[model samples]
Target: MTWTSYGATCSAPSAGYSASTFASAVQLLAAAQCFSEESLPDSSDQNFAAYDFIIVGAGASGCVLANRLSEIEHWNVLLIEAGGDPPVESSIPGYHFSLHNSDFNWRYKTVNDGRTNQGNQDGCIYWPRGKMVGGSTNINAMMYVQGNSEDYQRWFDAGNTEWTVEDVRRCFRKSENYQDQLLDQDPDIRNHYGHDGPLVINTFNSTERVRGNKLISAYDEIGIKKVKDINVANAFGAAIMTVTASNGERNSMSKAYLVPIKDRKNFSIMKNALVTKVLINDLNQAYGVLVEQNGVTVTIHANIEVILSAGALNTPQILMLSGIGPKEHLESKGIQTIVDLPMVGQNLIDHLLFPITVFSDELTENSEADDEFDNLKYFHNRSGPLAQNVVLDTFAFYATNEDAKYPEFEAYVLRKRKNSSGLKKEFVTLFRFTDHVADSIVELNQNHTLHLFLLSLLHPLSSGTITLSSNNPKDPPLINANYFADDNDLELMVSGIQKLLELLDTEYFKSIGGFLGRTRTPNCDELELGSREYWKCQCLDIVSTVFHPVKTCKMGQLESDSVVSSRLKVHGVENLRVVDGSVMPNHISGNTMAPCVMVAERAAELIKEDYNLY
Candidate 1:
């Protein structure tokens, strides 16, 4: 089938595509059944007996653990997930945003804090988590960014000695299987990236090349040199982003690690099974788990350990429900506390994004490149705009000021905001914004303006908590991110906005007719557009989450300040561990998925060593 936009239809394929190539693509598509609904293996094929390891969530970390642990023929691993297999839409890169609030998402929202979430309605921000087998990675914008080296160094300095930069890089390399196409361009076959592993990492198709070049040229003109490999230590600059996609399809954890081994005799996966609590005994030893599936309560014993991979939010909740949290709060909720771990749900850190948008007279939504034609092209050849994430093409890391020890700002280029009304919004009565400015933003957004820099604070001093709203496992927990509680975080964000303005003034940006000062930020029209004071006010008003929440069940040396130990074992408990984003001691300088995978990679080795599995 062919598609037309602007009254022009062409059967001619893209530059790299040809009629013979299309024939091969068609064969591959049919062979792989790429668009078919997911068919998860039936757990009944294997007996539901006691297991060597019972992983609580079939997410990024859990899937990795399942694959690695089950490699030993003697060990039996049971992976339980609260959601079913991923849908066809999950494989499409551009449908990342549309997956939110669907049945695939948990759709949890944080409690209203008068301090930050000022722009959100009722002070609450929509926090969407993937409810499917792969967890958040299934719904996330498939960006594959290994965090900066310094971020891992801080973990070592914080008493996590084994998590040094060199050590973690080994773990990253172990999990990565860099695509041959990507390495073909480099020619050196560098040791910096893993050449053989389960996960496939590569760059996007040629459709994004032009937009990436434009963004790189604009940044290069402003003295930010084009960095070919940002994966190296201390490296910075713009380049075509690396992603967790093999070819055009998203290579989620399920696709990369789990599905290939689903039929293994020693491994089993349970879907739509909600684990209520980790069953602990009199000695505070976790021996099993109590789960609710199909409205029936079932208990499964674990012969070895119960690893909680329920993510940053749900992991702590599961622990607290099992009576392993702060003593005072547990008693208040009428639950007896087994351990007085006050730090069970503290130290929550997230990356906050502040958008600076501008109008582009050169571009419009109805331009020759439209969504329908792109979709048609993707269906036919799997090489088009739909194959890449539309949110942004390029990313740059920068230090907010001279005092900073690490880069604090990560500015992303988001060019499309049409159909962006689905984003969170606040009632004007609650947030105090003028109607004219809000209307202006709405009007410009409809006219196909460019969403310039979404300035994200890589490190924020503010922290929040996750508490049980009620003693019910089915009810959502109360979450307060407490964004901008620290003055330094706000200052850093304001600095990032100023840096973006500096980029807009560059010759390359001006040549593209980019002018940011023309449109004033919503509710801040009383002040000058380019002044520092006005930007600071706008920063406060527009601050929102980048959806990178972590550090709630942080890893540390002391029991007083942390829930899990450096080895990922929960303090004061036996055979219980948190193996997901919740165990991060601090927020990493990049996306959390890669780090989550690394944690499981290391955790598996530790478990193997402790049990002498080898």
Candidate 2:
């Protein structure tokens, strides 16, 4: 497989091609330049470095904080990232599949306990975290969702009074730079989005493909209303999915927030640098961080604070490693406990998505010649299927059991996880599920498939934990996602699958030749297809993560139930705070990226307010 300036000549992706697939190699090198880290300003010093602020993990939140805090001119900020800059492949919206499990991905796996991942041979699950400048945004689906308003209301209800719906919506608007030029054509939709932030949010024109409109029509036929924008309140219906991209390229955090300010002397980025631990004084004030780079260890001091933004999985790991976690767990690992915050790694919650494959009689232009044309189209004008994401245009958020306060499930019409094919095959080999499920997915990859209905549980009752496997900072954390620990999660998931089947059977879907494909598992052979019992077994068998993990470093008023304060400061430690997805007090209604960015925006304000920067 050779990569060209326009695109690459490679074999079919594991998840197959969708309208969002890359077409050609044109401008590939130029696009790659957009995310390159070589041009970032360097501020490394030969001596021990001290700065106004030291932000750990140059992820979604970290990048935003760095950009915002550094704007004060005199305020020196240092951002450290475990991974390097994203590669050129990271620029293409459709190439996200190839980015996973690669050098750019942390590739963290969970330790299963027989309750979940029962379909896999080893009873384990694969969790991929971004290890690059933009962090997970470098490899995510790039969906731009702000989550339901009530989701934030729950945060306020949990003693977090500052993060009300109005406050969060303000932060959301403040953090976004909506580039949907079409919005100006509609006054109602125009009022729903922000226009002056750095990040660009837009959707592929609905007329660009027939599949997305067909899905929307099917949803409408099923009695679901059509929403003008899913990024605002009342996202309880089908709407065109917006993405975090400008033109056809991925608008990662590093690109959106960091690139414009790369030359600022007050701002410095340390890539490929792993922070070992936060340096705390006898008074429990964070002074700096111990970072390892190129076999050399150095202590970088932060005069103001040490902000932890290493994401949901790694933030708690870093805290625990610094002796700021549970007392008993730290003592057992032979690490001296500095601040015994039991809530540090607890309250782990994530959304689980079950991919329901359907067959369509229509053939998509995914052939070799068409791939070249698509690449050429993207290379020439940044348009066509190559310009979009894997998911189609329509997204539906609905409740299965609860009142319409918040969605119990979110359904998206998209292509398969071509990258997950190999992973699914491994699950089959591990006896995670019988051949009919994983193997069938692998076989269907060779077909001319169109769309997939990925029904994800919006609010799960189950929660898990992230613990230390070893004291070594180089070693990955032991993640116990503990999926489906509560039976209600499975029940809601089964109901969601039934709703998807109903959509497939709609006249609108039938007019487009959409047919439900049977997902058989040996464990459910006795139960009939489409039966609740069969789906329950299937949900337990193949249920996987949607990658929106949060609340591990929970925020609350009490120290016993939370890690960070309502202001985002660590409960007991002074001059230390966690400002990432982990600080979310509850599960969000949609993707976690927008919420994470919103957290960074709020964190910046809180930090500025504390220092009287205004």
Candidate 3:
């Protein structure tokens, strides 16, 4: 048996003569200046190689880490991504419809779509990961909400001391820049929010379709209470949504973390340079990576460290490819096993969300009218849905009993009004009144599609893994999400689903006509509350993913059934660490984006402290 070698950089990356694969590489890496390929400059120069640190998959944590580490005067950083940059449509506030099926979408389908696939209402579920530069954040809904204190405390209890609420809180504070006055009266909220940071945070301004005030008022009427700003340390009630945007344009982690420093002399980024595997020496220490570029293979050694920030899905994939995962799985792919770590890709978790579709003819009629339009008007004037968060228009975090264990309730309002009916259903006109008045210029032609995105950990007790499909670099790893395997998880979600019906029954649905239209994916006309059987049938039929995938590479101090220590260093491997959602010991209480960003901030500090960066 012989180990073939070919690389435009140093040793093994074949300069294939295959015209077809070369064209594919050429098509992928045409613009090689801003972000060059991890391979080489061209056919002539195939030996120019190496970097101080090679970070793969420019996602949330990867981008931030690249930016922070490369900032050092003498450090050399090489950031490689398998994808391209986002398109113009992804930047449009109203272009969310285009994001799902476009080029930016990785569009990885599930292997077990039949068992737990609410996202793919139609036969198969499509796990749309961003294959572009900024990764998923470029295409995500962009609602920025941090996990609560208890969420991180759970990590602390799980033996991750560095992940305690206070430890993680510092990271959360790094990305915040609050501009809310109500926070002045509330010390708890004020203490949590930071006044200085790279990202911007502000309340949703007033608009015709949706206003922050109107939402706060409505949620308040139901005893949910009004929050000055939910991003603060304590998130109790409804507050304006935080976003990853600046001046209406989405602020992707790539732009916020990397593009600004593109001109830095020591910094180099290779777009379309998919890392095939991390190169480990005889001592089992990671030293570099093998990347396939425009029809060429290349080796780029990391003189200092090899950091894996490929995100939840791809991070574990790369580790497995490098033979640093479960020994048996790699052997099946005909690859030599390095360190056998059982937890490399286990503990996968994600939110399976269900939208309670409803129609609103009277706008604020559910004790509310056809109020969904208020958001468009809000966005139009930079105040309504456009200014405020589409997810936080209204929400709740509640426990069913006096001594409940975890929060089992979370509901967000969405005013689809007239927008959701175009493909098949007939749209109705928007007629309303009150705090939000439709702008005369923005004459109301229709109603809104109001639905609540809810998910209470359907597979909380269940664990999953990420294994290699083949040794091929282009292939995505097998994602066994282990969704809905626990009965306790079902109990919590069912309770929330039942409560949602009650909210609808309270004149909320009747005021707007009482019948929330059905999804085209699968329609359920016979929804009755008297029986759990009927409810489960609809839930299994209609619910989909909220797109928050976490815990692929769990971290803990105990080191049992864990991939990395609480510090995020890979077990038994020196100069190698996994940073990103993959390191999350447990899922956060809310959106995973904010928490992922917080992870980058804290991890950067830890890296600096360990290296004594001043």
Candidate 4:
């Protein structure tokens, strides 16, 4: 059928029905049927059965552990998740933002410190974590960035001997199955990645290539040279990112690792299961978990170990609820302390993002018709704007000092079309910007297209903490982001903003008539708009997270400072381990998804060796 005829058919009324309508309607019906048939098995019937290994939180790490540990045919493994299956929108890359504030998201909000983030809604920042099987991978902008080698070097130097740069790289390679077309053209990139793994990694099929390339050129002119592959170059430049997707669909850890072995006799997956506490014995050994599922609470035992892959935030909460946290803090909440590990949730670190937006009159906005056609195009062959991440597939990483081994700043570019429909929703609902700030952005978009440069302080000296709001597991953990707690962090962010402002002077930007757009904030009205002081003011008022929280349950050589050891074993507690981003000693220089996978791969090997499974 012709494309024009299909479009006409989609708009036809009931009385004007034609053969084209039947054809188009049947395609959608068939697609829905296929989606319904693809479902994960709910093994809740076997909830009472004991397991050799019980992994809490079916996130990036937990899913990997479930797949790897269950490989041994004799061992029984249980994977429990707090949320149900991912929705159809999760599979579409461009719909990544649509998952926010939905059932799939944990929808966490940082406690309003009444100091920073004052320009956000309710004077608090929104932190969205994925509650489903793949965890944040289901909601994240699927960037596959294995942080700089020096990041792991610091881990090794800080008494985490098992995490040497070489070992870290090897684990990343083990979990990656790089499928980008560049592999056939570049030997260095080809040799740098694993080719036989289950997780597919490829560049997004971006439809905004012309504008994206122009932005890359602008970045190069500003000293962030365009590299063919940022991964091979150690994240020293700007480039199109590789993503965890295959054939226009998100390849979450659940899709890559769990779906293939859903029917394994030894593997059991329990969905909508909330693990309230780790069941520790009188001797401080975690034997199993107390799970609240289907409105019923049950104790599921584990013969070997109970691993906490419940992410940086939830893992520590679970530990504290089970009486394995700070002695005095547990007592304050009327829980007997089993282990006096004070660092259970002390060292929280996250990458804070500030917007440095620029407006251009030369760019054109996408129309409603264009969006509808793009949706139809995706249903046809999965090839359209809907098949890729929304203008988020490119990135620029740079260091303040030219000789620095790791990047101090990371920039993400997002384009907002002029007079576009979702601008208010994006600024208010997704970003939680205050009414004035959101209105300013929406108003500016009516006249000029916006190029928002979201600059993030990659490694902040300032760290926050996750503490118990109450003794109840159902209560959300109290998150004190404590951003800009260190003066040096704000200084670094201002420096990064100053450097990014140079992009307006680039040839591509100049040709497009680009000019710096100021968001109206009452706190910064007295200062000069483009001055360093004004940028610093904006940093304090407009800051939000990139949702990369780590190091809450830090790993180190001493129990005096850390909650877990080099082998991932919880200090002062036997048969309990933390395998998620919480074990990170420090924040990585880039995104956390890829590094989380690598951490899990290494942990899986460590578990196998300790148990003699191999």
Model 1 misplaced regions, further than 4 Å: 1-38, 44-47, 180-184, 187-189, 233-235, 364-369, 402-405, 417-438, 446-448, 517-525
Per-residue alpha-carbon lDDT of model 4 for 225-273, expressed as tens digits?
9998889989889988889986677888998889888889999889999
TM-score for all predictions? 0.89, 0.91, 0.80, 0.94
- The clash count for each model shown is 0, 19, 40, 0
lDDT of 1 by residue, 1-614 (tens): 33343454322111121123433443334224444223558583455668989998888899899999999999989999998877656776765665675777788887876655455555566678889888888888777778888788989999997687887888899999888475446644366788788998887664757766777777777655677755653436666677888667788898778977878888989888899999999988999999888897888999999999999889998999999999899898887899899998889888877767675655544543354455557766777766877656677776646555567777777665453442223213222334543455556656545565677888899999988987899999888888788887777677677766676677666766766733344456688876777777776655666788899899999999999988899999999988998888988887778888988998888889789864
lDDT rank order: 4, 2, 1, 3
lDDT of 2 by residue, 1-614 (tens): 22332242221112222223332334343343243222354455535479999999988999999999999999988999988767666677766765665778798877868766666546776688999888999889898888888889889988898788888888988977777776546776677677899888887633245766666777877767666677654567788888887777788888889988988878888888899999999999999999998888899999988999999999999999999999999888888999989998999999987867776665544654554566556655777655676567678887765457888888886664323334454435323455566766565555535356778898899999999988999999998887788988888788787876777778766765767666655476578877888788877777777889999999999989999998999988999999999999889889899999999999899889889984
Ranking by TM-score: 4, 2, 1, 3
Best by TM-score: 4
The local distance difference test score of model 3 is: 0.63
Per-residue lDDT value at 137 in model 3:
78
List ranges where model 2 is wrong by over 4 Å: 1-38, 45-48, 205-208, 365-368, 416-436, 442-450
lDDT of 3 by residue, 384-452 (tens): 333433444445555554354445555676554443323221111111111111121112323454543
Q: How does model 3 score by TM-score?
A: 0.80
lDDT of 3 at 78: 80
lDDT of all the models against the reference? Answer: 0.75, 0.78, 0.63, 0.85
